[model samples]
Structure formats: structure tokens, C-alpha cells
Target: MIFNIENSDVKVEIPALKHYSSDLLSFNINKLEVNYTGNSNPSIPACVQCSHPAKPMPDSYIYYFEVKINSINSTRPSIVIGFTDESFMLNKVIGSSRKSFGLRSDGKLIHTAVQTMDYCPKFTQNDIIGCGIAFISQKIFFTRNGILIGKAFDFTENFPMFASATLSSPQDSVLFNFVGPFGFKLDEVLADEKKVFNNQVQEEKVDCRNIFYLVKEYLEYEGYPDTLQALEEHMDLKKTEPSNSGVISECYKSLDSSCQNCETQGKICNFCTKKIIETVEAKTNIQIPEPRNHYNSISLSSLYLKNTDFLKNPSKNSSEHNTKNLKQRGILRQIIITGNIKEAIKYLTEFFPEMLNDELCMLYLTMQEFIELIKSREIYKALDFGREKLAKFRNYTVYYRKNYDIPISVSHAFGIIAYKNPHESPLAAFLTWAQLDLTADLVNNRIMMRTQRPRSCLERVFKHFLCMENLYQETSFVKIF
Candidate 1:
């Protein structure tokens, strides 16, 4: 990949070598390498120099640089390696702003003033720590030698970054290598990158960068510039343009607060508005268990069943009372694929005669053959459809459809098939065990009123905050995320 110096067409601009903290620190970047040379005092730090033309960081890509900490005058957050945008300055510390992130030698991540050790790795003299940033996940990672430590920082906003570093004492120095064992192992990160960009899998861990610095690296490695031109026409990571602080903060706050209640947690919903915009279908096979009979007086189940108050103080109708009485006779059980789908349907029809009018639903139910479910009902056939299929279904669907919006909403109709036992998953207890009785009670509530859609506590807080308007757009608010 070496190019002849005489005919080299590449335009390289290395950072102008200089000291930021007076004559306290010094470094050299000659011969296409960076090394801390000297230090006069420990008061100031040798930080960013003039614009050093480096490859544009990918919207999400991992590039490792070797950091051989040659000396340490003070072990107090001295040497640092990080990423910075065009705003990086020669007179300022490496990570002293929202746009800059630096990994300190003491195993902490610093963004301007904020420092955190949430995921920093140990760095010592001559230890080649691998440094990388994932914009999609808004995470920065470090690896000692070839081992990944963990994500170090959760960055706040998006910025086109370049590999950067700084030193305190003159003896406190570092060397950066962009080639070969780029400090970090490329193979280890390849799968994640592919999953994020190529395979297009819905994963939260994927690093998403709008720019493909890796592509430029490859072109430079292979000595091809023509491909680089064509690459610009394709999808550029810049299109993702990191949202403003207010927007980004709101999103992160929403996620942080709801992480516990989120069924998927950090497993899904990483992209901004991507999953929110897409609609996926839900499927289930297990039939809803009959409502459990209320025997115990102080039981939570009994309380849920008998409670008539809903929304405001709406009164119950005779039909609603009748439905409640019928529901009381039935007991809720986990939906089983092997169980009878007709049984659940029969219960529904008897309790809510209004469902009988839905010709489409009745047609699908009668046509579904549970021969395989019949097999599954046996210990051998009781497949882990709930664990395997339904979980993935929820990951895709996120939430259940309130009403049948599609022509074929077989999601509710859970049984019978021609060739297979059942295509739909059985209504296992895991899927609706805690829900069937409650949903049944809600349905049977005598009060007639519009039910509100469920909203997470995080959503309430975030929306409440977002609703307020400020003329200056700088009204201070408590920073949570």
C-alpha cells in the first residue's frame, strides 16, 4: 500500500506541531508519526494543533490507533486519546467541549469538562490501547492491546470526528498508528459493522456513521481514488446529521428513563424514528386461557375482576353486567397452541356478542386447523413458540395493534393449519399470563368510556418537558441523561 513519494498524488496535512500549555509540553509529528517529545512544566497540556487533515470518521466506524504512553509526570488524567471535529483548537485541551471526547490514561472518558469512568480501560506506558467511537450507539470504546474493554462514553451529539490525542508533562507522550494493527482488531468489529450497515439487522449495538472513512482507507490502501468519487454519490453518513442538543437530549432522556419498562431494553429501538415509523405485524399461537375464577376474597385477581370503576364515574349497562357475570365463570389459563382455539373464541363470543359480527375473524378461526397444535399440545409438540417466535414478533411489532388494520390479522386468530399444526403461536402464559384476566376485566367494565393508550412514565416526562416553549431557546433545565 506504499506510494512513491516522488509521484504521490495524496494530499496529506499533518497537525502543526506546537505546545498549548506554554513551553510546558512538546510533541513531534514528523516522518508521518506523532510522539511526545518534551515538557517544561506540569501546569499546562500539549493539546490540539492546527488542522491535521485526517480521513473523515464514518457515521459509524472503528479505527484504532496505537498509544504508547512513554512517560507520565503525573498519573492524574494526563495523557489522552480521543476524537474531535473541525472546531478542535490548538490552544485548548483535547476533550474540552461537547464536540470532543478523550480517553485519559487513568481510565476515564472526558468530554470537555465532564469525566466518567463508566467504561474506560487501563492504559500504561507502551500499552497500545485501541480507541474507537460508535456514533449510532453514541459510544466510545477502548481496548488494551487487542482486547476490548467496553464502551467508555455515551456522547451527547453527532460530530464528524478525527482521531486526536494530548499530553501533559513533556515526558507524557503518545504515538498514533492509522495503519496495520490499527491498535484495535478490525476483525472483531467487522461483524457489528456488517450487522449495522450491510445485513441491515435491527440491532442496538451497531455503530452508525454517516461517513465511511473505512471506505476511504480502503481506497487509499489499494491506491484507488476513482472509487472514492463514486462513493460520494451513494449514501453518505452525513444524511443522518446529528440532531441539535435539545432533540438529542430529549431522545436520550426518554430512553434512559424508560429502559427498565422497555420490553426490548437496549436490544432494539436504537435508530432515531426508524422503528417508530415502521409498522410490523404481531403473531401468536397459544390460545388465551379461560379467565381464572375468583375464590380468594383479597386476591389481586379478584380485585381486578370485580372493580367496576373505569376512567371517570361512568355507569355500567345491563349487557356489560351480563358480560362480567359470564367472565367470572371462566378461568384464565396460559394460551397453548395444542389447546383449543375454539374454546377461547367461544368464550369471547359468549361474553362479547359484538365480536360475532366480525365475519373475517370467524372465517379465519374456523379455517385454521390445529392438527399440529394437537401434536404440540402433547409434551413433545409443546414447542417453545412463545419464547422463540413471539419474542421476535414483539421485537418487531413493538406494540400490539389496537384494532385489525390489516386485511389478515391472524395475530388474534391463534390456531389450525392445513399442512402444519399451527402457524400462529399459542397464547402462552408468558405472553398474556399477567394480562388476560386484566384485559378481560377491562373489557367487561360496566363503565362506557374511551380507553387511553398506555404511555410509559418516561414518555410522560419527556412530552411534558417538550411541550414548554422558550424565546431564547436557552432556558436551563435539569440535565438527567
Candidate 2:
């Protein structure tokens, strides 16, 4: 009867050995050599395009060993194979029943049997051999019988086994033997490399001030500096041309003199001469008195006259006559300030011929009253006053242009006043006519246009007036009209 083993199904042929002894005979396995020539037939499906016909070893086939036994005795048989020290031993027993043993492709073993007699027989064999017990060609552990005997072989066709006399376990040293040449001194080598690296790091440190200075120099050479002081300093380093040198010299020469004009060879151009004229004129007019002078004069009496003896008898004292004239001038100035233009003009013509040149004073008083009339919407009064002033100034401008050869700026002032007056005033029409004649004179070289501020002021005022008129016309009152 054929009996299958416990684990692996390998077949074993057992022949009846009829020896009458109680000792079971063990097979001679010390020189056992099992040869595996690979699979007998190609295990992989045939691919017409493949260059090789057979499937390779380590994938297609596995080889292992098996054993079986039968006995006529009534007792059971047992077998054991294992390693002791550097040697291998196998022991076996036979009984009356059949027995079987199996060895898997993975190097494990299993057995099955039953006894039929009262006596037992035993047989054992060790050092059974085959190709190195391996799952893959590279993962082979070579053994003789059940004991490890040699190093694993490459088993790959072209590769040969490499040997080294200095085999060391991984735990034996600081570095693994697998790490080729620099393994032993790895820590020392790394420390040296790190030291050199730190030296490079120290060498790469740069002083910020030196870097900034170099950058500044480069920028100045390229004609741009980060700061105004750097730019000025760079410019100062450049060579000066003759013209620039001359200008500097002239500036220094001017600064050294007390008076720039005194450098000219004129006896009348002394600093004292300039000072004496200004002092005399300043004392004479005394119009815009200093704040301290005004404060001091605040306590003076408001009496109309201190002495009338000069009025009663002018020829008795020249100083008395001077006092009379001063009183008259004061009264005229009061009228001008009161914006009584007609009365002021009459008084000035009768008493003060020299004060007629006070155009700014007259213009100031006139503008104040005129602007009040405009705000009050007294259109007729504003037009009347504005027209009278425009006519007066226009005549004065013409007279100045014809007689003094000095261009008067009065026309522009008159134009501005007339333009600001109410629309009912014929003054703007008159101003336009007068401006045409003035413009012609200006073009013909008789009058200077620069002195005339009237044109721009008139244009602005007229445009504003026209805009107001349009707005008024759009209202309900105009719609009803």
C-alpha cells in the first residue's frame, strides 16, 4: 500500500529488507549528494518572441527529500535527524505497520506511521545532500545532513562566490563591514571635513561698513549716490572749469565787499551815500510807521490843533505855516480813508499836490467801499462808483504813458473794478473800448504790456459774472419772465 506523508506529498519507494535482527539498518548518508539539474520540462508558457526557451531555476522548480518504511514487527518505528555540535546524526525505528517521512521544499520535515508487531526496528541516515536549500538563488544556506557545513554559494550561472578572510558581525564594530574603505575612520573623517567647512564659513564673514563703503564708491563712480552728502562730496572732487572758477571768484569778491555796487569806481556810489538817501526818504514819508512808533503815538491827544496862531498869522513864523500845511494833509488823508473819493480828490487838488502819487492808498480805499457795495447788492451804486474810478484811472494811465514814459498799472486795476461791478453798469463796455486802444499801444511799442495786470483780472471777473448770470437766468424768476 502507498501512504502519503503528513505535510509534503513526495513519493518514496520502500523495498522489503528481510533481515531477522532487532536492529534497524540505517542508509549510508554521509556522502549523499542530490543533484538538481533544474526542471525536466519548460515550466513557462512558450512565447514565440522570447529568446530563451526554458524557464530559469529558482522560480520554476523546487527539490527536496522524502523517506518511507515498512516493517513485519508488531512494534512502532521512529526516525530522528538533527545536528549536534559540528556533526549530524539520524536515528530510525521500524514497526509492523507502514511509516512515512516527508521533507518540504522549505527544509522542514514531517512523518506518519502505525505499528503492527510487538518489536520495533529503527533506521537513521544523516548528511543527506542536495543543492543548497534555497528559495531564491541568492538566499542559499549550505548544509551537510542536518548541520550547517559551508557558506552559501552564488548559484547564479556567471557569478562566482566572493570570499573575505575578515568577516565580522555588525555588532562587533562601530561601522559595518559592508561599508567598504572609509568605514573605520568615518567619524574622524567627518569631523575634519566639518572643521574645514567651519573655516570657510568664518572666512566668508564680511564687515558691513566696508561693504557699504565699496557700494558708495561704486555708486559715485556710476554717477548716482544713495545720499545727498555723498553726491555733493563726489561733485566737489571733480576738476573745476575756467568758467566755474571765475564764477566762484566773483562770488567771493562780492562777499568780501560791504557794498557790491561800491566796487565800481564812482564817487557817488559809496555805502554812506546809499544810506543817507534811504534815511532821508524814510523820515520824510513815514507812511507805514513801525509798530513801536504806533504804540508810542497811541497816547497823543486827539485835539484838532495845538495852536491856531499860525492860522491867524502865517507870516509870523515859518514853522507855523508848516504846521498849517501838516494839518491840511492830515485832513485830506482822513477823507481818503473815509472812502469819500470825491471830497478827498477835491481836498488833495487844493492842498497836497505831492500826495497825488499815492495811487496805492487811493486804490485801497476805493476797493474797500466798492466791495461793500457789491456785497450789499447795490448794483447801481457799485456801477456808478466803479465807472467813475475806471475813467479816472484810465485818464491817469494815458497821461502817465504820454508824459512820464513810465507805464502805469492803473488800467488793469480799473478793468478789474469795472468787471466786478454789476452787469447793468456800462463801465465794462467802456473798459473794453479803452483796453483795445491800450492793447494797440502795447503792440506798437507805446505802452508796456507787462505793467498792465488788468487783462487777466478782467477776464476772470467777466467769466465769473457770465456764469452767475447764466445761473440766475435758469431760476424760476427768469423762467416766468
Candidate 3:
């Protein structure tokens, strides 16, 4: 579902969130936090949106908000952020039901049973939590301050869910911040429901040193041994010993004992393998041989075939070949990208017959289905179906589509077309080879073979993130095709 984060004045009503309150309990906002005063008969519980299609929010549309526990009267007070289909009750805590899922303040996940306690950051008071409810993925996430405490809950049942909270003591209360003390740029906050199920959130340290391995992988894959060797020499890297590990990734294996890595408490040391490697290295000074000369490369332009071919040949045959090579019009590309399934399929049959095959058909059909949902304005079902379908292509051959003469990766391409009216703006005349040409050369090898396709890299994601350094930022949500 699309998010209108531009609305800053919106505030979640305290009454909607409270499922039940002790008759003596009173809730009020004090110092920017929701505060509750109760005379000790259990506590008050609350909810925000408790059903599918709650007002402006449609089913399966991801809803996000921030909550801060400003202060609690009890030292051992408990706080809960939970989801459930059941009605709120006075004495009930969120995880009391089999259908309900809850994340407790002490970092425990409570459903019918207490799962793990140490998985999340524990907070006492004055801490903010970024809470996200994703109906499409049927999962929830809680961010501690800014650090995203990943998927906290997954409820399989299709019943409507209400975002709920509970206070452990008469003194306990929590404030809802629909707007936020945001840790990340608003642009990075997820709005795309499709990315909810597939989205991977990782916090990795930026290292310029990693570029060396990236370049090494690139040169080896592209058959540029000479240039690679020159780079290694310039960088003063030691000539690596030829590996027996059979790994072709950026990281190489050391001859460290496998026992060191795999050993539990009492495994015996296996020194035989270590001894062999050491003895060989000591005696032979083992290293990969230097890269060879350029005799192997045969450029297509190198062969000179009687440079006067066009001069001698008749114009009639040449004209026919040129006509055969003519490209399909820009309009056909537009139709395919704009969700005109029937027309797009027709063009495919006439031009790219191969794209009408099973794989492409399945891809287009899925895209068409999602487009129908968008047209019908069924954001919930559209998000649900979209996630389920794209999950299959997790082990994707997205790179195969890099040969754009074929199609953009069906997953990425369809996403752009899904929201955009191909009839207008940038997409109307946007199939420029120059842009695709630059991207094709850069990221192709980096994809490699993977158990799962990665989300777009940060450089790619932030390329269109127009904001800079805090204060009244206006950033664009870019759907990269």
C-alpha cells in the first residue's frame, strides 16, 4: 500500500489503542508521552487499527508508527506491542491468546509460549520503538530507537489484526508517535508492500577496502587477467597461493584448521591437514603463476575481410538484411511496460516469440494480476499476491534480464510499471539504451549465483534519494526497473 508520510499532523488516538482500562485509570499526554494513572487493579490495554480495511488503510497495506515509553511509575513495569484478531479485554495481556503475537518490553516474544528473550534490545523507560505491521507479509518488526529489531511476529491466520498495547501496572502508560523521532531518513522507511516480505534490512559497515575484492572478482569474471595483475601489483597485494577450497567468491579460505571453526567444546584436533599445507608452502614457496600474455583475446574487429565488401555487393540484398534488423517501435515497449497485458502479449508474439514461453508467460501473468489489484484498488490482496509470487524467484536469474534486448528482470520491471502510468511522465519515453547500457556493465557480475537475490545496493537505492542532512527533507520514492 502507498504511504502518505507527508502528513505530519496525524496522531493516533489513545482511545483506539486502549483495549481495556481499569475504571480508576486515567490516560493523558504529559511531556510528549502517553501517561496512565490507575489505582493498582491490573491495568489498561489499548489498540490502534484492529481490523482489515481500517478507514483509509486497506488490507495488507503496511502501517508504520513509532511509540515512546517516556516514563513508567513501576520499576518492574511491562509494555507490549502486539497484534491479534480477538477483542481487547480488561485483564488480558496481548500474548494471552493462541492467535495473538506480542513483543514484550523485556525483549521476550510471547505467543502461546515465550520464545526467546535476548533477541531484542531491552528498554526500561524513555525509549522509542519503531513498530511496523505488514498485512501482506503477516509479520511485524520493532525497531529499538533506530536499530531495527527484525521480524518479531508472524501470524498465519488471515483474520483481521489490530495493533494493540498493554500496561503492566497502574503506573504504566505509553505514548504513540504516529510521526516519529526518526532514526533513518524517511525515504528509506519502507512504503512498498512487495518489499515487506522480500525486503532484507541489514546494517553493514561501509569499507572502501572491499572494492579491491570487488575489482578482483570483476576482472576474473570478465577475462581480464592482465589488468587484474597490474592492479594487484599497484596495490602491493601478495601473490595468492592457488586455492584448493574450490570457492570462487571474493573471500578466500585460509589453511586454518576446520576443527577450529567447527569444534564444539571437546572435539579433537586434526593436525594432519595443517601439517601438509605448511610443509608444502615451506618447501615450494607455492603461489599462483603470473598472468599470461594477450594472445588468447580475439577481438571481433581484428579480422579484416576484404574491406571493400559494400563497394562490390549490390544494394538490393543489403537493403533486405537492414530491414530485417529494424527494431520494434518505442510504442510497443511502452504497451508492455504499462500493463496492457493483451496488447503487450500480442506484440511479444509478433516480435519476441521466445518471451511468450512458460517462464515469461508466468511472469507477465503475475504482473497482470497485481495490476488488476491496483486497478480495482485492492491494495491488500495485491500486496499479498505480489509477495507470494516474487518469493519464488528468490533464487532469481535477474541477471539474465540484463540483456535488455530480452526484458528487464520481470520482478523489478513489473514493479515500475505497476505504479506508474506508462502513458505519462518519464516512463512515456524512458526506454533509453544509454541509461541501461551504463547499468548493464556495472552490476552484472556482482549478482553472481546466490541462494537469494539481494535488495538493491545502497548506492543504487540512494541514487534517487534527493534529500540531504536533516531539516525539511523532500525525498523521492524511486522504483528502479
Candidate that scores best on lDDT: 3
TM-score of each: 0.35, 0.18, 0.34
Candidate 1 accuracy as TM-score? 0.35
Q: After superposition, how far is residue 412 of candidate 2 from its true place, in Å?
A: 1.2
lDDT tens per residue, model 2, 262-318: 333221122323232243323321111111223212111110222222233332212
Q: Write the per-residue lDDT of candidate 1 for residues 35-112, one digit (tens) a residue.
A: 455434535655653244333233224444555566564557667777777767644676787777777777777776
Clashes, model 1: 36
Better of 1 and 2 by lDDT: 1
Instruction: Evaluate all candidate structures by whole-model CA lDDT and list the values in order.
Output: 0.42, 0.30, 0.45
lDDT of 3 by residue, 250-304 (tens): 1213333344421331211123223333434344322221112222111111111
In candidate 1, stretches whose alpha carbon ends up further than 4 angstroms from where it belongs are 1-25, 29-42, 49-61, 135-138, 198-481
lDDT, candidate 3, equals: 0.45
RMSD, every candidate, angstroms: 25.2, 42.8, 24.3
